[model samples]
Target: MVLEGLGKSLRDVLGRVNSSSVIDEDLIKDVARELQRALLQADVNVQLVLELTNRIQDRALHEEPPAGRSPKDHVNKIIYEELVGLLDNGEGLELKPQTIMMVGLYGQGKTTSTGKLANYFVKKGFTVGLIGADVYRPAALDQLKQLGEKVNAEVYGEPGEKDAAKIVKNGLSKLSGKKIIIIDTSGRHALEDDLIQELKDIAAVAKPQERILVLDSQVGQQAGPQAEAFHNAVGVTGVILTKMDGTAKGGGALSAVAKTKARIVFIGTGEHIRDLEPFDADRFISRLLGMGDLASLVQIAKEEIGEDEAFEKVAKNMLSGKFTLTDMYQQMQAMTKMGTLQKVMSMIPGMSKMEDKIDYDASQAKLSKYKVILDSMTVNEKDEPTLIKGKRIDRIAAGAGVTGHDVRELLKQYNQSKKMMGSIGKDRKMRKKMMKQMAGMDPNALQDME
Candidate 1:
């Protein structure tokens, strides 16, 4: 969700062009102007923004709607395709045995991205290895070692070796069994000659399958120059953008790197080791425009919850009007496993806009509090809440170490959820529709609700 403001602005512009709006020249012009403004505000290069908007405007005005597609849908599709073309490299990484050499300037998150990348491959069942070739940074090897341990990947490093090439050569020999070997090179404060030369020497020794340049999203317009310099020096085959969770200038970095003709292989969405995701421009633009990215949502769900049969039983119970505090607690636990509520919410279509209206941290804390309150309740109270009167409420509140108001809030939420389940259960038509929707969901999604 980097460049949130820009995403909001662009979405608003699209919202204005509803089905009722006529697809005339004036409407296209207005949309083009709004898009230009949003891109500029997001710190995209002026020339690039103009070029993109011009192409969008031309296509919107000239392209004919396909069969069964409305004019509005056609224009929107045009914009989506153009934006994807602007950012995507149109190729995916070959997830086979390969040696990747990571290079970047200091403070660009090169070291952290190395760990994240290693973890990503490990999750895909690759035998990954990390080589600490960054001898200039005193603690680089230690950091890599810790990350390798956390991800259960092997680490090979000569802590005292001053020659980066020698360390890379030795690490390669030691980690020959690894399916994916990542060499973390030392970075400079700036793009200096010595850093470039060092990278060249290491590349010569390692003969990396992919020379990736890690650029911080906040680098803005400078991303182009930096990528060019790296490509000139050691031949950057791909780029990895980091710190994209909330960067205002992420658009600039992405577009700039794309302009360099180096494919963007991955993006660091958050600081967590599991936050690294493969870059897919189409899905990214879809999420940005409030269309959602169900693939990513399913991927995260698969990683977190897997295929839990408990969820299937819960779904059946809910359909049969058997929901209780226990069910709610179990559901909340599953949600907690799927990372932050905001992140989970943004993956659903129409929920990205809701993230701004809700306080995610406060909401998460409330969920935990609700679980604790539920734990303090007796079985009778959890199943038949009407059995609890004022005195019982106070006792439950005291046991849960919460105030009476908090207990009442939980009860209110429980009552609401119960009513919803009861309505769905009683109406056979609604139950059928719900089942159909659940059946359409990906099997790998959080849990199979059916």
Candidate 2:
């Protein structure tokens, strides 16, 4: 959600382009100016902003739209491509066996990101080991130990050990069984000589395949110089932008780091341990432009649900025109695991554009009540909702500690959902059409299905 203002501005500019009857030089220049303004407001470097806007203007005026594609669409596509170019395009760090050393200034969330990186590999079936080489910071080793427990990874640290390189050397031998090893080195309030030398010593002992610099997005364009300093010292291979959820200067950090040798490999989106995500510039831009990021959404669902079979079964049952209350309850549970309704919707292409129209709080409240009501019901009642007559409703409400009216409201919702799903399920032609559309849906038009 960083750079939300920039995203909104970009979307509005694109909307103007969509509304225009014709693509003219004036419109292109205007769009370019608006983009410059937005980028500047987001704390992007002025020089980079000018360069990007100039490229957009040039491409829009000279480039021809592809066959059957409207001029407006071509311009939009150009904008998307150009915007993506302003960020790292390299594939994220590979998932194979590797040792990674985390380096950054103090308070940049280096240790937290180390855990997140380890968690990422752990989820991918890698055996991870964390080395706490940060000897200067009090409780740093303890923090790493706790995070290691959270991710089910082993942590190696030596209490009262002043020599970081020696600790890393011992940790490597101790956690040699781990397929992936991540070393967390000490950080300073600023990148000083001692911190640089300490990192070099640790790197020498660890011989890591990757050195990651965790930069805070709030630092804005200053991230570039800091990243460069780390890269110069010990060859930082990748960067992780932290605190991206609410930073207005994230745009600056992103653009600045893109110019550095160390490309962005991940972004810390929230406080949750699972909120760290691999950074993909294209998908990121898609979301920023209000075009959604279905790939990321699917990835989140896979991570939360842990099985594609569950999704397939739900789809099949929904389309069969007959699904039990248990099925509905399970579906709701899945949604809850996926994330907030607002977050889920924002990933669904044009749905981000409809954020203002949605009553997310009301929807979340209703969902909670529905879940509680469903929980209060008997297994048989859940499987067969028709059994829930007057007495059953009263019993369920009392069990849930809600009014009977709330219980009935839930049933009404279930019936409405059943009717809607049934309409599509009972109609073979409609079902076929939906399947076909989903299989070949244009990424940009994905929200039409909603």
Candidate 3:
């Protein structure tokens, strides 16, 4: 969803401009101009915009899409492929037992990204280790330890060490049997020569397969110069664009790419560990021009959500019996991720008409009240909402700041939803159809609802 607005705007303009099926030169030119304007407006570099536009125009004019496909489809494909090519043309990084140095300014997310990348390697079935050479602050060591615990990666650091370079050297020596070692270094407020020298000394010991520079996305044009400075100092092999969930233009990233000519390896979309998206040039650009990108979403879900958790969810539904309130709550959380009812409904071809009746706001509001009621219940009450006799109901109701009837209302809604899911489980074809429909919603929907 990094390019959400850019994608939407391009889609809107294309949808409105052409009514014909023919792939005319004029229409293509118009689309290119509009797209260039859109990318440039998004804070993309002028040269990058021109380069993308040229590639899009050249291929779209000569390309022959599948028979009966809309001209828009071909254009979307060209945009996706070209952007992807621009983004990731280099051979992918070799995945081996070598070090990866994460560098960025203080507060630029080196500490978090180091762990996320290590988590990625761990999820891929690699034995990963972490060396937190950041001795600038004791809080940093704690931060790395907490993140390492979350990912279950071994973090090596000296809490009292004053010299960052010595910490890196000693930490790497202690860690054994790791296929991947990520060293998180101390950051500075700006590009200081002393800091650069310190990083070089650490790099000499680590011999990193990759030295990635993480940067904020809100700096607009300033990102180019910053990337250049870092590249010149310690040599950046790749860039990690962080904080992309906000409305930041992130044009600065484009500048950084131009300045360093380094590949973008990963992007941090949100605060969650699973919010990292491996850079994909093709599908991303395609989506920017209003074509949906499914590749990244599928990868994220498959990697982050364990197969066992998925199996549990699937197995419970197969029994065709009463689903407990616990199950209902889990489903509500999943739906919160999948998307709003109205948005999900819109993806279903015929259900577009039912959008007005979906009552998403009402449903979500009711869900909030349901959670409150659940929190106030005793252990016995949660297991059996029916066992909450009038006296217990009153106590629970007062505890949750709601009427006893509101508690009953929550149970009623949960029961109704459970029955619906149970019913859906009975119809394999319908469930499959609904799942497909849900997948077609925006990627954020998938993340939000699931």
Lowest lDDT 10-mer window, candidate 1?
435-444
> What is the Cα-based lDDT of residue 31 in candidate 3?
79
* Candidate 1 wrongly placed segments (more than 4 Å): 292-450
Better of 1 and 3 by TM-score: 1
lDDT of each: 0.74, 0.76, 0.67
Tens digit of lDDT per residue, candidate 1, span 167-280?
Answer: 999989999999999999999887899888999999999999899889888877777778878989888888888887754557667666666778889888778897677786
The lDDT, on a scale of 0 to 1, for candidate 2 is 0.76
Q: Please, what are the lDDT tens digits per residue for candidate 3 over residues 99-147?
A: 8999888888899898898889888888778988787757988888988
lDDT of 2 by residue, 31-102 (tens): 999998888887787888998899999999999886756787778878888988878557798989999999
Please report, as a residue range, the 10-residue window in candidate 2 with the lowest summed lDDT: 435-444
User: What C-alpha lDDT does candidate 1 achieve relative to the native structure?
Assistant: 0.74
Q: After superposition, how far is residue 377 of candidate 1 from its true place, in Å?
A: 34
C-alpha RMSD by candidate, in order: 11.8, 12.3, 13.6
What's the C-alpha lDDT at position 74 in model 3?
60
